[model samples]
Target: MSKKQEQVLCIDRKTLPASWVTQRTVLSMDFPTFAATCTKAKCSFVRRGIAEEDRQKKQIIPYILLQTADGGMTAAYNRQGNEKRLHDLWSIGIGGHINPEDSAIGTDSFESILKKGMQRELDEELARRVAGDPIEFIGIISEDITPVGSVHMGAVFLIRTQDPEGYLPGDELRSFTWHATQKLSQLNLELWSELSLELINSLNPTL
Candidate 1:
């Protein structure tokens, strides 16, 4: 199959049956805990460190969430052996570990970190489908904190492009779609840190 076609057929690893899509009991958590667990595991690319400015220790991961003009968002879903999972089950933002090169040279500013994270994720996921340069940054939506037990802070960013119609999901993402901002409430998203949701919601009113 062509690269474009392959991406279109991609299904998130955690595909759930249609019956569970609107199931109230199943939709209790909005933000998936898998990422947080991955962060805590400290495996491979993931790492724990302290901020250079204030020396505040934090678990940092390079993450990106796509924000369209209509306030729609995109996320990757992790399929844990469920065939009936809905499209939303595999929905998660793009992101990974921030490598040494990402912070190399003079690119240590928050903006720099954001730019590097977004670029790396897009390149890795859409490399087969997109031929041009990387996607541009719209703005920083908010910085989120994980729950008390977790030692990580989530940085939510708002990003977009003139043409968002052609995103090809690689192994990391099963599929991609534009989810309405208002619908975010339907998902059972638990912020890792305190007030993370409030911060993100405040920054993006539609969320």
Candidate 2:
């Protein structure tokens, strides 16, 4: 096995709640299948409406969310020209679309796909921030369907690190910080999606 696959194997799924384990099976069936159906229908509809050239350029994006041991979340902002808009950040998880390469892995199982997707996005986004350091995988904590109108399936992973100090926001992020779990309600930031919040609450219920 590759080093990355070996590290992923070290994650202990037994550490998660029994209820979460059962729920994961149900979610794996519901969301990914629903997402696949939606993608097919959307592509069919778009192909009928647009020109051939435009259709070829379209892309579908996958979704991902990241949780830190501390409760702080990552978000991006649009700045006005040259003003250096600080604090315009929003709260969100790290994830993107599943590329064609991801589809060739021969995994039809949603759980397998979700796990692979998490590793891909984390490595792509956090690599530079860590300066090539390693990230340890924990286990999946929760999963959810995005709003009906949205075109992405969301999965929340419960990740922990002995050293939670190396993370730095990339250019897309205005700023990122680890906030106390209790203080999440006080901030004006967007509320984390239900699954994301559930994972956080599972880890630190008092918050």
Q: How many residue-pair clashes does candidate 1 contain?
A: 29
Q: Candidate 1, residues 13-97: lDDT per residue as tens digits?
A: 1232232222111111222333343233332222222221221233344345555544455443443322232223443445544
* Residue pairs with backbone overlap in model 2: 62-97
- TM-scores of the candidates in the order shown: 0.49, 0.48
Residue-pair clash count for candidate 2? 1
**Model 2 over residues 1-207: C-alpha lDDT tens digits?**
322122111112243334433332213223454445433333211221122123122223233444444445433222222213223434445654344344455544434444466567767655444434343322232322212212222344444433456665455544555655555555554322334555546555775
lDDT values, one for every candidate:
0.39, 0.39
Candidate 1 ranges with C-alpha deviation above 4 Å? 1-56, 72-76, 79-91, 104-114, 128-149, 188-200, 204-207
Model 1 quality (TM-score):
0.49
Instruction: Identify the candidate with maximal TM-score.
Output: 1
Report the Cα RMSD per candidate.
13.7, 11.7
Q: How high a TM-score does candidate 2 get?
A: 0.48
